[model samples]
Target chain A: MDFKELDPILHSQLRLAVVSLLISVREAEFTFLKEKTNSTAGNLSVQINKLKDAGYIEVTKQFSKNYPQTICKITKKGIESFEDYVKALQSYMNPGGN
Target chain B: MQPVYCFINRLFKPKFQSMQSENFSPKDSLLLIDSMINQAKNRFTENGFLYLLWGWLIFISAVSHFILLKTRLLKHPEMIWMSCWVAIIFQIIYLVRKNKKEKVKTYSDGIIDNIWMCFGICMMVLIIIVSRNNLWIYMYPFTLMIYGIPTFLSGVTMQFTPLKIGGISCWALAILSTITLPIYYLLLLAAAVLIAWIIPGYLLRKKFKNQH
Candidate 1:
C-alpha cells in the first residue's frame, strides 16, 4: 500500500490552523486570526508571513483610526493546496484506495 | 542491531522533518481543519438591528396611515411615510459604523448585503411607478409581494425557518390584500411587516445573543 505525501507547508499546526480559518471566511483581520487560533502575535506573524511568501495567502496592511490593521485572505492556490492536502491525508487513512 | 537502528532513523528522518515541529497525525490534522472551519462558520452573529428597525418603522407607518385616513384627521396621511427618509439616513450611519467595527468579512455577509440593496432599489422603483400612474390603490398588495422576496431569500441564506415562514406569510397576505377594500390595505401591510420582519427580527436577535 502506498500513502500519498502531505504538503510540507500545511503540515505544521499553526500554519494549518491559519489556512483553515482563512479558507472559511472571505477575509479576516490579524487580531481575529490570533483570537481564533490562540497563537501569540510573534508566532502568528511568522506563520502568516510564511503563507504569504508561499503565495498561498494575501496580506494587506493599512491604518484604521490611526491604528495599523492587517487583513488576510486565502488565494486560489491556497484553496487548491488545502484540498489536495486533505485528499493526501485521506489516502493515508484508506491506503487501499477503496 | 545498532546499525539497523541508525538506518531506520535515517530513512524516516526526512518524513518526520516534513511533519514539522507540531508533528500531528493525519487524523489530528483533519480534526483541526474541521474545528477551525466550524469556528469561522459560527463566528458571525446577526444583531437583527436593521431588521427590527425597518420592521417597526413600517409597522408604525402603516398603522398611523390607517388611523389618520379613517378619522380624516390629516389632509395628507401619505406624508407619514416620509419618516422613512430619516430611517434611511440612520441606516446609512449604522452601516458605516458597523463596517468600521467588523474584523472579518464572510461570503454570506456580502451576499446578504447585495440582497438588501436590491430590495431597496426594487422598492424605490415600485413606489415611483405606482405614484406616477396614480396607482396608489394597488400599492399595498404589490408592496407586500415585494417584502416577501428579500425575506424569503434571506431566510434561505441564513438557514432560519422562522424567516422562511414569515416570508410565506407575506405572500399570503399580499394575495388577500387584492380581495379586500382599499381601506384595509394598511392593515395588510402592517401584518406583513409584523410577520416577515418583526417576528424573525426578534428570533434572530435571540439566536445571536445565545451564540455570543
Candidate 2:
C-alpha cells in the first residue's frame, strides 16, 4: 500500500551520482569526482563532506607529485547503503506484491 | 525523511547555479543514477596506444629478423630485438604519462595492469630460460604461448571479441610454430602480432575515439 522510504543520504541526485561513481572505482580524486559530477568546487566539496559525515565514504588527504590530493573511496557500508537504496527504488518503481 | 537533517549538515547551505537536483522526485533520481552508472561503465580506454606501438615495432622487427636470416646479411641478428628494448623504454614512458593523465582508476584498470605485469615477468623468464637451455629453441613459439595468456584474459575481462579471437590466434600460431622449423617461427610471430595486437589495437582506438 505504501512505497519504501528512500535513504535521504542517497536521495539527492548529486549525492547519488557521487556514490554511483565511487561504487565502480576503487578510489577517485576529489577533482575527478568534481569533473565527473560537473559540480562547482564549493558544491562538490559540500556534498562530499555530507557523504563523509554519513560514514559512506572515506576521504584521504595526501600529496601526489608535490601537490595536495584529496581522494574519495566508498566504504563497505556505502556499498550496502547504495544497494539498499537501489532495492527501495526498484520496489517503488515496481509497486510489486512479492 | 524530514528536511531538518539538511539544516544540520554543512551541505546544501550555499545555493548553487543548479540546485534543482537537491530537491528531485523519484523519477528524476532514477534518471541521474542511470546516467551516472552508465558513465562509469563506458570508460574503456587503456593499452590501445601501446598495443599499436608495440605491435608495429615487433612486427617490423620480426619481419626484419626473418629477412636477415634468409639473406644471411647481418653478422649479428639479435640486434633487431634490441629495438624492442628501446621500444620497451618508450612504452614505459607512455604508460607512466597515461597513468598520470587518468583521473579515475577503475577496478578493471588495476586488474588489466596486473595481467600485463605478469606477461612482462613471463617474458623475462623466457629470456632467461632460452639463454640457459637450447632445447626450447624456437623462441617465438614459447613467446606466443606467453602472449596468449594475457591477451585472452584481457579480452575475456573486457568482453572484447577481437582480443579474444586474437589471443586464440596466437595460441594456434604458437602450436603451429612448434611443429614447423625455427625459420618459420618469425613469420608466426608476425602473424600473431598482426592478428592479436595490431588489428585489435586499431579497433580499440577506433572504439575509444567514437565514444569520445
lDDT of each: 0.87, 0.83
Clashing pairs in 2: none
User: What would the per-residue lDDT of candidate 1 be over residues B1-212, giving only the tens digit for each residue?
Assistant: 34433443354467667544556667788899999999998874577889999999999999999999999999999999999999999999999978767788888888889999999999999989999999988888998998898899889888888888988999999999878999999999999999999988999998888877
Tens digits of per-residue lDDT, candidate 2, B161-188, equal 9999999999999889868888889889
Q: Report model 2's TM-score to 2 decimal places.
A: 0.85
Considering only N, C-alpha and C atoms within 3 Å, which residue pairs clash in candidate 1? none
For every model shown, the clashing-pair count is 0, 0
- Give the docking tier of candidate 2: acceptable
